[model samples]
Target: ASITERFEPAISWDQVARLREIWKGAMVTKGPLGAQDVVRAVELGCDGVYLSNHGGRQLDQVAHPLDLLVAARRAVGRKTTILLDSGIRCGADVAIALACGADYCLVGRPYLYGLAAAGQAGVEFVIGMIAEELGRTLQLLGLAGVADLKAAGEGVVRYGGSPASRPGDTGDFGVLQ
Candidate 1:
């Protein structure tokens, strides 16, 4: 069959409900860009909601997952798992996601690039690089570990641009050094 003929433009919530009914394993709904959708997925029995913009390849100028993450977390509370992806190119990005409220981050492109360059070894190298960078980022933030990120919450990162008047604003709440 042709791609157009096979592709379904929309998947109804009823379909997701049916899937939840039959699938015993954890069910995660991907590509939710708004808090409402994230909450909706949880209400529909999805084990987790994956926040992504498909690398913005599917649609131009879509909201980045990071932009929506905080609100999603607030809407769903801490109990429902929230997985984040898209524009996550570095360990600091993972830390930022976790600080903002993601329980897990899906790193796709870097590992794929590694695989393409040197198969399994390349993939391992990329993973190691990311982990090392994350450790460095945590250290710089004065955090003891990943759990500290959760404890600090959004305080670990500065949102918007740092205030010019403050000049080295580490003392301020939510301002990163």
Candidate 2:
């Protein structure tokens, strides 16, 4: 699809399951979409939807996760969870995701970096680092577990909302989109 096309290129709802892919290098590229893909996901009794573009890595010049978040939420409504993960790098990303009606967020690159650095140990270290940071953050803000956060994550500030909203952007097509 062109960068200018949002939903204009949409296919029918029944054809997405049979969607085809185009291979490039070692990558598998998706053909296109059908609305029933979303509806089918709903009919299959999903609790939520994930509106991520693999951190923009799956396809070049594709929209980022945040850019797709609002529309996805509007499609799924409040009954389902709308989780996001693509380029989230810090606590601020998590905060914005929650604020924008996302039920959950995941950090892909950070853990991957940890994994690259030291395998399982690197992953554990990253988790420990996050735990330590959260502890310090909670202590400074007088907050408890994540469930204890209010409008924001206590001491953490918003990263000025999602990263995709900025001007002069192409698209992020790396880190699994």
Best-fitting candidate, scored by lDDT: 1
Residues 1-177 of candidate 2 have per-residue lDDT tens digits of 676575555554344333322222221112212223444566544444566667767664765666555555556666666667777765545555554556777778888899999999998888777667655554555556555653442123323324323353334321111
RMSD for each model, in Å, please? 4.4, 10.0
My TM-score estimates for the predictions, one after another, are: 0.86, 0.56
Per residue, candidate 1 scores C-alpha lDDT tens digits across 46-145 of: 9899888888787548778877888898899988999888877778878878888899998999999999999999999999999998899999988899
lDDT of 1 at 78: 87
**Model 2 deviation from the true structure expressed as Cα RMSD, one decimal place:** 10.0
Angstrom error at residue 36, model 1: 0.6
For each candidate, what is the lDDT? 0.82, 0.53
Error of 1 at 21 (Å): 2.1
**Model 1 steric clash pairs:** none
